[model samples]
Target: MPPHIRIYDVTQNISSMLPVYPGDPGFSREVLKSLEWGDPYTLSALHLSAHAGTHIDAPSHFIRGGRSVHEIPIERLIMMVDLIDSGTVVSPENLSGLNPLAEGVIFRTGSLTGYLSEGAARACVDRRLKLIGTDALSVDSSEEDAVHRLLLSNDMLILEGLYLEGVPAGVHTLLCMPLKIEGAEASPVRAILAPAEWHQWIL
Candidate 1:
C-alpha cells in the first residue's frame, strides 16, 4: 500500500446534466418503476456511450480484428507508470525528461483538445512506452497525432480524455480498469492513483 495519494474524482459527469458531444446521445435517467406514495422501491436506468466519459479506447477502436475491451491482456494495462506534467505539447528536443521510456506514461496536458504530435509520439513509442494516458480529450490529429497511432499500433493502451489534476508527477500505483464489454471498441473507465510508497513493504 502506497502512502495514500488522495485520489480525486476526475471523471466527468455522467448524468443528464452532463454535456455531450454534438450528435452524441445525451445522458438520460428514467424511473422504470417508482417508489413514492405507494411503491416500495424505485428502479432507475441510464443511457450513455461507453466512450462518453473518461474512457479507454481498446485496440478494436482502430485496427480491425483488434482485441475488444474484454479480450485485452492485463500486462499492458497494469504496468508501472511515469507521469509527465509537460504544460502542453513540447518541442521535438525537449522530451529528454522522459528519457528511458520503457514504462507506461501519463501526460498531464490539462485540456481535452486531443492532439497527437508525431515527433513526441515517436520518441515515446519508438522507445517502447507500454501505455499512454493523457488528460487531453484526444491523442491524435492535433499537431501530428500519428504518435498516438504509432503507440497503439504496437498493442499499447491509449488512455485519453482523463482529468488528472493534483495528481503528483511521480511513480504511483494505478488501478485503471475499463468496463468489460464483449467485442466493444472501447469502454468508460474509473482511473485512480495511490501514492508510490513501495519502499514501505520492502523494509
Candidate 2:
C-alpha cells in the first residue's frame, strides 16, 4: 500500500496584521453587508496590494515588457522543489552546491524579514531555476530591489512571505496557485507543500 501523505500550507494569513513592505499597501477589508445587520447576506470588499501576504512576483514586476501574473504557465507553479535551510544570509557561496536537477527552490531563512544577496540571485539565474520561494517578506532587502530585478528579468517566478515555520528542508512538491490577474505584475498565492514521496502522484 502507498504511504499516507501529508500536505503543509506555507502561505501567510492575509489579514490587516500581516506585514507589508515599507511602501507597499497593507491588506484591508470593508464589510458591505452583514447578516447580523439584517442584510440577509454577508458581503465584503477587499483591498490589497498585488504583492500582499504570500504572493508570487511575475516578470513584469521589474521588467518593462515582461510577462505578467496571468501569463505564467501553470505547470511552472507546481513542481518538485528543493528546500534549503539557508540561514539568514543567502550569498552565492551558500547556494554553491545546489541541485542542478531542481526546477524549484524554496529557502528557509529563519526570518520573517530578510533578503537574498545580489550574488545569490545571480547564482539562481545561472542555475536556470523555474521558481524561487522564500520565508522572507521580500527577496530583496529594504535597501535595494536588485534580487527581484535579476530573477524576474530572467523570467523566473518568485514566491515571497511564506510561513515555513516547521517545514523540513529537502525534496518536496510545491503547489503554488496565484490569482489570474490580467496585466498585474504580481498576485497573492496559496502555497502548499507535500513530501517528495507524493510528487509522482501529484504531478
Candidate 3:
C-alpha cells in the first residue's frame, strides 16, 4: 500500500447540536432497539434534511426537470479543488488571478455573511468550473435563487455547509461523495481534502 497522505475532513458532524437552515429539519436519531433494553442489537433511525451538514446540491434543487442526485456524474464529485479564503463576500475581484481550469473551487468563508455575488457566480461558470463549495450555509442569502439558478443552469454542482475552519488555501484533491438517492435534489456528503499528489493513489 502507498503511504497515507494527510487528509482534512471538511464535513460537519450531523447531530442534534448542529444548526440547520431556517425551517429545515434538524438532525435527530431515534433508537428503535437498544442494548440497554436487552435487545439483540442496537438500531437507530436518523431524521434530517438532505441538505443537513456538508452536502451537495443537484441542479434539480433549483431548476425544474434538472438532473437529480443519482444522476450526477461521480467524476464531478471528486476532482482538483482550489481552496480560497475570500472572507465575507466572494466578489469577482476575489476570483481574479485564479486558475481558470480548476475542476472545483471551495470558498472558506469564515462568516455567515460570506457569499458569492451574481457576477462571481458567472465568473465561476465562465471559468468552466464543474463545482463550487462554501463553508457557509448558502452562497447568497439575499439573492439565493438567482445565484443558484446561475450556477445550476450552467451544470455546476454546489457544496454547502462545509466545516473548513482550519483548511489552508491551496490546490487540493477533493473527495466528496453524496448518497445516490433516486430523484432527490440534494444529499449529505462526507467531504474531505488531501494533498493533490494523493489523487492518483486514491483513484
* Candidate 3 TM-score, true structure as reference: 0.94
Tell me the lDDT of candidate 1. Answer: 0.67
Q: Model 2 over residues 1-203: C-alpha lDDT tens digits?
A: 98677789998899999999888988999999999899989999999999998999999999999999999888888788888889887888767667666788888888867779899899888888988889988898877888998999899999999998888777888999999999999999999998775667766
lDDT of 3 by residue, 93-117 (tens): 7788675546889888797557888
Q: Deviation in angstroms for 105 in model 3?
A: 0.5
Regions of candidate 1 where Cα sits further than 4 Å from its true position: 1-5, 8-10, 17-23, 90-94, 99-102, 142-148, 197-203
Cα lDDT tens digits, model 1, 45-116, are: 878877776778877777777778998776555555667776566334435676352367777876666454
Question: Which parts of model 2 are misplaced by more than 4 Å?
Answer: none
Model 2: lowest-lDDT 10 consecutive positions: 93-102
Cα RMSD (angstroms) for every candidate in the order listed: 3.6, 1.4, 1.9
Q: Deviation in angstroms for 107 in model 2?
A: 0.9
1 or 3: which has the higher TM-score?
Answer: 3
C-alpha lDDT score of every prediction, in listed order: 0.67, 0.87, 0.87
